[model samples]
Target: MSAASAFDDDIRRARALEQANPAEAGRIYMSVLEQDPANIEASNALERLNDPHRYSSWMRINCVIDPRDDIFRFIGTGPYSHNPIREYLSDGWRTLSELMVVMDKLDQPLTRVSSFLEFASGFGRFTRHLVKVLPGRVACSDVMPGSMEFAREQFGVEAFYSSFEPEQIEFPRRYEVVFVLSLLTHLPIEVWGRWLKVLAGAVAPGGVLIFTVHNEEVLRDQLGVKFDETGYSFLPSSESPSLEASQYGTSLATAQVVAEQVRQALGTDPVLWEECAFWVGHDAIAIRPHG
Candidate 1:
């Protein structure tokens, strides 16, 4: 077989081995890179592997990860340096790809978006990649300390202080495309609708608000959690160490539950919906506030 097909075969085999034997998967990716140093596919895969995550300037992003940014720390390769910053940087590209599909589904091509917001943008993992595409059009907000500053300084995008209480977060300006990734999946039910309304207000007239959420059925089936009639569940625990457990725990809700919240917040049905479109299991939906 050709070298291209050989790389494909190796990547496929490595992916199959990742869950059961990550070391073997990393070795396979390393072998691919040994043959082809500039292979984007191998580079992205290897970056995510925590088997001593090293940086070889795979993507060559000229940004620094915050020391307190637990999101980056979780997958990073070392204690002193953020070598796996590559994964935090590259996995964000996949997020961009997902947003492309959502934007197309809403008839709002991402390339044409005049302004964008990444709400609750923890450590700018995805925002870094977003700035590469939209540049000056991008703005990021987060409650995490130093998150907004790092985003602004490193990516040259707008940055704002975010609050746990959505009502307290007044934006510098509204956005044509407001994207909230992995945030609703962590909010309690009491504030879910409130936050949704606040985000709806941040969307420019005729613009869309996009976000990701954990599926309620997945909560029940995979996590074995019992949901009430509202079809919501909260674990009061998460990987984030900066936020309060009760305030920013893991959340899951059904489409019906989320739809009602949207109706109450934006007075409109979702313009686009996709199950497991983001992060493989989180549901993604986009709604136009003006409509």
Candidate 2:
């Protein structure tokens, strides 16, 4: 068979394995390889069929697990609140491939900080990556205790309470870098302003505050952009927007406008905004200096 034909065969078989029994697929490939050690295709297929969850990199972040999977209460939803990273990765090959380029643009040393804070750390997918990239003391905080516990168990990092409410949790003397990926988008204007101020205060004078926001203008150009009927800022809604509800849950703005707002609210002197277009979304990286 031609190499192309063999490759096509592998793809078809792999899809079948995915649909039928991924577990069995791994065994089959291993069994075939034992019989004929020269079978490179079978070896490759087996490697490809290996469980994604088995990798430390994939499993170290437990927040990535489905929340509804017996650990958390289920409100009759099928499994969990949908795997965001899984969903993102489904279309994220290009995005994942561009990480090096993104890091290059940031140009910050990975080992510069002794401690770090990840706001809205989600399932800690990005946090795990950051942990590997950044050295020294690492602290992860999430709005959800479930997520914090999961991260603690999986990554072995110190987890802390991230809410504004008073709690026994004690933060370190200061953090060298405070990062919030996709966290600002969930906050309304007023709340975001407050968090930005608090975050600014938390950073050591020369540290970096890295964050992403829904840009107002570029989102207007996306295929399905819509405005809230409540006449608030243009927010894309799964359903119609109401005045009582703010756009936090439903709208995305252009990165440029978000950058501008951060400049006005945080510091006017030297905030750097970079437009990052990836497969999952368009984001701006705002590097704000502390104090």
Candidate 3:
């Protein structure tokens, strides 16, 4: 068969199987993996379907028992103190809803999985969001001991502290949904490749890897903002205009480039890439192929 025809055929078959027997979608995905072990899309679909317990555990651990400290009360009274945790966590839920729209278009169910490993999980907000909306288990790790401790005490999440250096950890098991939000925008570009490799290794084959980064165009439009090389803003609200400021977000290409670099570093491809316009740039969702 011609490449175009073969591609069309596979899409039709995959869509049909997904529509007719969504529950058995994993089995069909396994066949796709058999054809190409490194097919990230197939691997992700299978992974999300097969791991129910891990996802459920995450929801119970993070959502049911929040671990954040009362840091929300510490921010000075102003726009900063206006429920930052709720604002941040709700943003993640909004993003997840956008992803669900895509899944709905593809005639796929947004099934929950065993565990979601949220790296750089600041105060476990993303973990909190996932457990609340998705119904899954969560394992959150950060480089800051204070962040982890605060998260544990306040949010009741199973938090761990692992530094960006050496880039290693000893988790009990590989996570099914590994996520990194507003994380790459904090690290130096040179460090991202190593982090990507580590994150790839952290995910079980057939798991989904979600993350965010900046787009240069958006950054260009917001020039004069005091931003780190990764385009992270450190300015307080009084110092800069809200539009130009980072506000813990970046442009689409900034994230896309990092995701590509990470894929190259890991030698794996992402099944899906969603560049939504919530804050700015792209917050992509990638799935590694099953072996």
Candidate 4:
């Protein structure tokens, strides 16, 4: 190890601000750890950041966010344009809180789940806070290679590759909570249910598969969209940079349409569908097989 220099003073400042301004403190710790991953002071402080009860600001906001994470770009807005890094991290926590509510509705709290699968997880946005909550049990999957790796190395969890073709997407094993947040909201009409069927298969027996969608209300109100005869609509654009927009564009559907897709995907419809359960636009549909 190298001798400490001005970095020690930075750590001191971080310590002094821990209670008064944890967000700034965490940002400082993250900065230190980024420079010296072995710094005990910053490492220990980051460990504390994983506390579920700690303020949302306790987690380091910008430890390793790639500059290419387009979602981060999308989140940068208004005052956040100056420092979207902070809002990016807080926004993840917001998603976690929303999931907790869904779990409660399903009678399956986060504490009870033995394993979790975050499908289409991008760049550890929600994965970061999720690891703090689920820890060792968390697993992530995405077509983007670096994303899963980033989550595994930074957050300490399992990760695997997901393919564009639903039949080709492999899983190491089943999970009690298989969350496909926002992915369905973007899949093109041609292969929506095909992807849904494959994801549903990843859910352990008696477990829930929770996925989000842009429902009719959100489409009509937010995007001024009108669903076609198929009861859904899509546009060939999104925040992604790699995936072809034609296949991974934005999509919206009515609750009835989404429920039918779930039924057709899994041959059953034991789904708990809630409209505008989050983001005041995305609908959450959690499906579990019949007893």
Best by lDDT: 1
Q: Write the per-residue lDDT of candidate 3 for residues 1-291, one digit (tens) a residue.
A: 012243345545665777567656656555554554333345335434543422223334332212232222222222543433334334556656765564444344345566767777765545555555554366788764477776666455677887646366766578776777666664555566777777777888767666665555556466534445564333322211222234323322344465567677776665666654335554455656352
Q: Give the clash total for candidate 1.
A: 0
Which candidate number would show the highest TM-score if scored against the true structure?
4
Cα lDDT tens digits for candidate 2, 1-291? 113343445445655786489876666555544444333345445445555432233533222343322211221122332532333222223433344354346664545556677766654555555665553367778655477787676567777767653233355556766766665665555455566666766667667676765554455555456545432243333221221245335445544455556677676533545555443355646455644
lDDT of 1 by residue, 1-291 (tens): 114465898899998998899989988888886775434456557656654443434454534556567776555534432335455666778888988988888888888889999898888788877877786899889988788888877789889998877899989998998999888888887787899989989999989888888766677788777767878777899878778999988887777888887787668888777888887588888888888
lDDT of candidate model 4 versus the reference? 0.76
Give the deviation of candidate 1 from the true structure as CA RMSD. Answer: 10.9
Clashes of each: 0, 7, 31, 0
Give each prediction's root-mean-square deviation over alpha carbons.
10.9, 10.6, 19.7, 7.7
Candidate 4 global Cα RMSD: 7.7
Q: Model 4 over residues 1-291: C-alpha lDDT tens digits?
A: 323365999999988998888888888888876675434456557556653322343564424565446676677543434445556667788898998998998899987789999998888888888877776899999877587777777778898888888898779999888998899888875687788778878889889888888767767877788767888777898877677998888876777787787777778875677777776688888888533
Model 1, residue 67: distance off in Å is 1.5
Lowest-lDDT window of 10 residues in candidate 2? 68-77
Order of candidates by lDDT, top first?
A: 1, 4, 3, 2
Candidate 2 local Cα displacement, residue 234, angstroms: 6.9
Which candidate, 3 or 4, would have the higher lDDT against the true structure?
4
- Model 3 stretches with alpha carbons more than 4 Å out: 1-89, 95-111, 134-136, 153-155, 222-260, 289-291
